[model samples]
Target: MESRRRTFLRIATLELCERFGFYGLQSVSVLYFVRTMGLSEQGAIMLWGAFSALMFGVPVLGGWLGDRMLGARRTVAVALALLATGYTGLASGMGGAAGVSLVLAVLVCGGGIFKPNITSLLRHAFSDGDDRLDIVFTIYYMSINVGATIAALAIPFLAVHIGWQASFGVSAAVLWIGFAVSLTLPATAPPPAGGGDRRLWLLLGAGIGVAFTLLHYPALAKICIWIAAAAIVLIWIVLYRRAAPIWRAGLKLSFALQAEAILFFLFNQQIATSLTGFARDHLAGTIRLAGVDWAVQPGQFQSLNNLWIVIFAPCLAALYYHAERKGRPISVPIRFLFGFVLLTASFVLWRAAALAGAAGPISPWWMVAGYALFSLGELLIAALGLAVIARYAPPDGVGRLMGCFSVFGGLASYLGSLVATYGMAGSGTASTAGYTHLFGNLAALSAIVALASALFIPFARKMDAHWRHAIPRPSSTDKTPTEILP
Candidate 1:
């Protein structure tokens, strides 16, 4: 138990630093494109969508490399190095818009490589049946938010005061710090078992080439995304058909949960795009809290999402742990249903605020309130997403499945960006009415998803039961697996 705890902390710390750098970049990315690069709001959003899609879409390859080639630890090391390099390039402001886009491609490649493998390593550190997995992942989720919250708050402030270059440089420095921390990971953590240095070099070269090509030809993003989406579906079908009968139920459950996750991410993507824009244009810049009026930048408002997560993650973790200890743990399906409901309420709240502020800027408090609910919803869904794969995916294929999960999320992100484009103000000045319409449509969509989730509860419960029953249990006399390393 002590060893597992240590492993968890090390991995979580690494993730925290990576997230700090990544979210810092995200906090200012769209704004940089619009303000620094002189792109229109719509163009910035579209480019962001393309970047996000590729960022997540590449994880499928990363997962394969981690699982079948370079190993998770080595892949992560390479990814961190790539990320640092890309951020440094951005900080230098070398080639203008084209240069930034090229560096973004590098960042996308780095993110794709890092995202899946680190979580897979954590999942491998524990026994599959351990009830603590949910609690562990929930805390892991909080670690990510901790980094994100700080970056979201600080990076944008730096961008406003110092310069965009300085803020990006900070991100580069943070990633280098993460790389240093990665070296301290315990030897017990998974090590490279397959593929040689040759394979690693080849993959790195191929990834960069593909990322650069996709970025240069933005139109290819939509086509590639659709093709990737179809490919994932086909792969899932093949996996389902080939899986053992006992594994089929779990796969079905995983597929359903993953589909739900895709929908949730569509809403999640708005945080750095539409929500940030809304905050910048129509929302009050100052928020009152406990008799203090605090000024916040539009980008800084993105921190509210992570801030709420930091405050509530521990509470949710405790609730989950206690419930499991009491042998009355909340079911995933129920959690997902509640998540969608909260998401619906969040959009509704935002919609109301947009309408109320049609004449002028609304109180930032509306954002705070909406983000609280939205963050909780994210905790229940996005945070647990990996837990679902860990709990339900076939052990041998968890890495690949994790990658597939990210692919779904990437597709959803692109779709969400498209959705946000509709809300973009055609002129220089953004109107509250555009946001009002967007939020209203989002509210309707979330409500429909919530209803669908509620309706699927019974079926999902049956799937859960079959999966639990199908799992093999060790006898009381048998020792726990030592693969996790003590």
Candidate 2:
């Protein structure tokens, strides 16, 4: 078990590194489109929405392949290959929108295969009923934020310094690195309960990784992510969960989980949506420290959010870990409350920035303040929820459930874009009024989120209890086929 833990850490390092590489490429995509692609601010929001949705939406398909067809190992490698191709096309500027759209679509789908599979692989490292879950999830959360931190710093600088296409090239490079790592991994990675080791296949996979990195064919990449994704889908069919009498409780959890996930997803898109715009438009001239440069771009402020995550994820993880140990306060519902509260505060920062913009450049600290608050909110609900979700859902269908988790975020992003479009479209040019309408609407949404959450507390507080009652507890007379006790 200790050896497996060590190996899991190694894999986590590589996986997080991959995440950093990918998000670094993604974080500044909106800025690239707005400044480079000549998209309207709102149009950029829409693009962001589409991008986010596709990135998330593809996971259902990806998981299908990972579980049913290709398995995690092949699915991840092939997805990486496709990702590399998409970036190659993006960097070389080899095609028109149609071509690029196809490339983007393929890349998005590839993400579906890659993202969830990678996450699922990490999660599976902790077995059913493992007591170390909270700690393990915290460690996993750190990697997520660490990747985000890198993305926040790297992508914006790359985009600002080079062309958008070149910025995209970096994404390809990251995925290639991930592919290199993936190939070397022992097939026992999601470790077979009982199995044999095959080093030759690992080396062969490495060669393929090198070859594709050398190749700049988006077409090939798309084909690869697609095939890998397709393979996983077929595999999923093979592993599809069978119905059982106890599944009713699990199904109820799934429905609530879907709703819960969507709300958090909406919460996350703020980074790409209003948050980015707020930083860029309002903070270029403010936020100076004696030794630090305030000349940093708006997008750069996002780095602070990820940085705080590094500081906070482990702390929050520890808090919950201890709470669980003592049988005291920690649980999903309470954590979710914090999420709503923090998100509300994030909007307050946006509101403050809007109010202050009339004076001069809104203080960059305001941006940091908002992001920090938002990140805090996310940690409580958005971040920890991923771990909780795996816990609450049926183990047999975990990937598909996670896929829904990813989709919830996409749906929220899509809604945000739609809201932003309609919220801003009817107004005049991007003036104070335009900003007002946008910020004002976001504020309202944030408030509603808070209120909705507060209302849910009474119901959610009873969830674990309700769930316990809803299912049978193990005892002498009631020996179940599986162990699913709290």
Q: What's the residue-level lDDT of 258 in candidate 1?
A: 78
Q: Report the number of the highest-TM-score candidate.
A: 1
Kindly give the stretch of ten consecutive residues in candidate 1 with the minimal lDDT sum. 477-486
Best by lDDT: 1
| RMSD over all Cα atoms, model 2 | 7.4
TM-score between model 1 and native: 0.88
| Tens-place lDDT digits, model 2, residues 1-486 | 786687577667666756765576557766655564555666666666666666766667666667655667767777777677777777777553344455665566566678767866666566575787766776776777777777777777777788677877877777678777777654523423322225424533443343333223433533444454455445434433453445544455445544664676665666766666666665565456997765675566667878877777777768866776776745555566667778777776677677778676766777777777877777777644456456556567675656655655665676666565543543212444456666666667767766766676565545555656666577878645321223
- Which runs of model 1 end up more than 4 angstroms from their true locations? 1-10, 67-71, 120-140, 184-195, 392-397, 428-430, 463-486
- Kindly list the per-residue Cα lDDT of model 1 for residues 367-410, writing each as its tens digit: 99999999999888874677777877787778677777788888
The lDDT per prediction is 0.82, 0.62
Q: Judge candidate 1 against the unseen true structure and give its global Cα lDDT, from 0 to 1.
A: 0.82
